[model samples]
Target: MSSDDHGLLPAELAEAARPAIAEARGKPARDAARILAEAGLTGVCAQEDDGGMALGLSFALAIAEEAGAGQLRFPLLDQILLAQAFAGQDIAGRIAAGEALGVIGWEGARDGLLRLSDDCDCDVVLVPTGQGADLIERAGLTATPTPLLDPDAPQIWLDVGAARKIGSLSGEQMADLRRAGEALYGGFVTGAAANALALSSDYLAARVQFGRPLSSKQAVRHHLARMKLLLEMSRAALARSLARDELGNPRDTRPAFLGAVGNAIWTLEKAIHLHGGMGFTWEVPLHYSLRDIRKIETAFGAGRLARQVAQDFIRAA
Candidate 1:
């Protein structure tokens, strides 16, 4: 990736997101989605020919990180990945224009009724069925509200029928798209972990006990150091993966993305502990960060399943 593109795009997008974050806070999710769309944030990686900026994988990850930092309620990951996957398709233009949203059933979801993400008024759901992109119009599907770990991210059950075939993707291409999803998840976790760490650090510095701030204690300082270390390492790994993606080499990203996601989870989980009992409650955003990270970690595949996939990818490399 060009050095200029690496830092500049993310920096500008993150800065531009400040007001959008404020506007989205404590409001219905549509407001957040609208804010992101209005800022051109929703279409960061969309093909320019399809009315999108076509910002590439690196920018897409940056957008995820920035959006996650604010705990943005929009389904940005879904939108960006789907936009890129379905580029040149009819729905792509609508997705770029913010006129519609898209979701993907990436985990072995083919035909039949399936529950995708929560209700975002998705216009189409793309099921990666190995052969090609199968498009299920919202009209053809039924959505029922479902619970989710991240309140910002809603879920719904869709009674999918025979979907209209729109495009095709090879197995390798589908795997790459899945890897992109994981990377985007990592980026989000990185942002959330960083935010949580900052919150805990600030809390420790301000929280006084035994005539000294909690941060004065060596143990507390160690926690802060570890959190910082994890955040930096994850960022570095993601940067490397992005560099590879920039060079048109997308393989082996799964390992780095998984490693980053695992580190981010640990960092945020510890961040919660550092906050003590208060962290367990809704009074602080730590709970939200922790919840979201944990959920995203397991979304596509969890525990041994996720590990095996990563190992397989690494071994094949």
Candidate 2:
């Protein structure tokens, strides 16, 4: 019965997310992320001592779905979850205290080089690149506001010398953290896709087409069905991965993680296409959600997921 509640998000998480996204629409998602840290919603996968909500991934996925539907750009999930995965520690309270602002850039080339604050939002940055605090001492970096397709855009500039490694991750732990980042990142995309579909659905249901509601069109109904299918697939993939983690099995999470990325990528692409010209324009917000999903898709190598899928197919064959 809350204004924003449509069953995609839990009552409390949905409420918290809606306002935080509203506040960030003016500034940046980084600015809105403070609410997540304060609410203890960011590090949902973190340990008890880590100042996290200690919530499970299914709940997180549900929240992500609503966030996407709203075209919300808050970095609560990205900053906090990535930070915890990087450090294996809960620093949400530090983030809430404003003593630190967490930001992450996925380091694909150097798995050993931990770039904790490459976004440089924090006063004391931690990097697995090296622990000399050298990254902190680098004063010649600038932050740039990179406007995304959405109103809530965040951008940062890193001076080449502005980062250094503080620690290293190896073996299974390293791989697990990487999967964690991909899964969480893709989860946000799934959320965004869900949001776009809802927006489109509402518009279709109300706006007249051929002297009737767009939803009355058989073709329109099909498009909506396709969107829902993709959305559900992404949600289930994320859920399965998180459930595995809950069951004390981390090894099989990668496929579920990758499945989400692939499903979200396809779903958002369809959403934008179905909305036609309006989806391309800034006046309509569906593009924002689509664009955000694309951003995460590219960052997490969604384009390459087909190869992984094919390999799995071959293995099964």
Candidate 2 lDDT by residue in tens digits, 1-317: 12323354454675666665555554544555666555555655454465555555555655665566566655555544544554433344455433356554444424323322124354433332222112132244444444543334433334434444443445454455555665666677777767767877887888786699988989889988987888788777766665545556664555665666667666666666767777677777666665666556554455566577578779999
Question: By lDDT, who's the top model here?
Answer: 1
Candidate 2 lDDT for residue 237 = 76
lDDT of 2: 0.56
lDDT (Cα, 0-100) at 296 in candidate 1: 64
Clashing pairs in 1: 117-155, 118-154, 118-155, 132-168
C-alpha TM-scores of all predictions: 0.86, 0.74
Worst 10 residues of 1 by lDDT: 1-10
What's the TM for model 1? Answer: 0.86
- Clashing residue pairs in all predictions, respectively, total 4, 16
lDDT against the true structure, each candidate = 0.72, 0.56
For each candidate, C-alpha RMSD in Å? 3.1, 6.0
Highest TM-score: give the candidate number: 1
Q: Which ten residues in a row have the lowest lDDT in candidate 2?
A: 128-137
Output the lDDT of residue 294, model 1.
Answer: 65
